[model samples]
Target: MELWPASLAEITPDLYATEEVESEDKEVVAKFFALGSSLTWYVVEAQKLEFGDVLFFGYVHTGDWNSEWGYFTLKELEQQRYLGGIPRIERDLHFEKKRFGELDLEQ
Candidate 1:
């Protein structure tokens, strides 16, 4: 699907942008083995990130949906993927609320 970020962010001016997240904004990606719904994560070296650190260049979900793009360690992600077995990424990131909605928009 095609997304028009410019229209939404520019019209609102205060919502579209990249911000450095804190510890709570980080996401965890992992590979898991599932047997009929029973899942087990792969914590081996292959699950590690490729770079020392990773930051997602994505937007967060809000307004009834509590979700964020989340940060990760790239080197670790790539390393883990190279392990050879079936591996995937899993992360538990958080969502935030907007506090500037109260501002009056200039028509």
Candidate 2:
């Protein structure tokens, strides 16, 4: 699947655009996850770097105890693969924009 579509890039805010907003109030623009893993990413903002790569910032839930906000890149996600060489990460096409506080992170 195409992970970073033009439609997504149009909706996602540039990096640091939400810096003034409280964490809970930050709007999550998109969602991504590993096809067969518990890992998930809630993207809040993104920016194209000088090298022409997009960098994403948001909440990453690796597990119940390892969720945190940080930066990741398009290249990193594209490079991920499962044991059989299947692409691992995929964007959640059905995701709707919502505030961070509205998420049911407890799952």
Candidate 3:
């Protein structure tokens, strides 16, 4: 198994290349334990930008977390209705449409 960065945003290309090699050789590595599945992964970490806080990227299996699987902002997470408001579960209806082409509800 080999790990390599798939892309570079701009600021550091050489750093990404070097990191890719380290990641592959296991010198530098990352692991994610969330949503139940243990995943070996990497993250760019949070960066402060001119507009606001920015987080690069990371990935884990869908089964790791029971998320509806879509893009979301931290603000949205804070505003989610589950602990109070409209309920995040309802939001999955949209994902059902996007992923399965329809909301079966039965699943």
Candidate 4:
């Protein structure tokens, strides 16, 4: 995913503790977004993984707990900390006939 060019180098850090101390965590998490009109796009998911934790986040964001916006994952999160920050971007990955994993991380 494309993080806002202005975002910090380690835009996202220590999303949370791992299975060593896990729970069905859910909260209003801020991720570096490259699209739309904000430095970060507030999305929801089962988890917002950072570092080498390769896994897909879940859907369902909510103030009162009810606003499913689909899931996002972290592949290059660890490989390139400089480009991560945004989890589960929705830049036409579904409508553009493209897969989320199709995004280039070689930059």
In terms of TM-score, the best-performing candidate is 2
Q: How accurate locally is residue 16 in candidate 4, as Cα lDDT from 0 to 100?
A: 38
lDDT by residue (23-93, candidate 2, tens digit) is: 99999988999887889999999998777678999999987877899999988898899777889999988
lDDT of 4 by residue, 1-107 (tens): 44322232133223332223222333323343334332222322233335534333423333233534444544433233334544434332222212223423222
lDDT of each: 0.28, 0.90, 0.28, 0.33
Q: Indicate which candidate wins on lDDT.
A: 2
lDDT of 2 at 24: 97
Q: State in Å the error of residue 53, model 1.
A: 4.8
lDDT of 1 by residue, 1-107 (tens): 11112222233222123234342432212222222332222111111124434323332333234433433233433344324653343332221223323211121
Q: Rank the candidates by lDDT, best first.
A: 2, 4, 1, 3
Total residue pair clashes for candidate 1: 20
The root-mean-square deviation over C-alpha atoms between each candidate and the true structure, in angstroms, is 14.1, 1.3, 14.4, 13.7
Number of backbone collisions per candidate, in order? 20, 0, 1, 2
For candidate 3, the per-residue lDDT at 79 reads 39
> lDDT of candidate 2?
0.90
Model 3 C-alpha lDDT per residue in residues 1-107, reported as the tens digit of each score: 11122222233222234334322232212222222233222323223334442333332224435433222222333333433454331211111102122222232
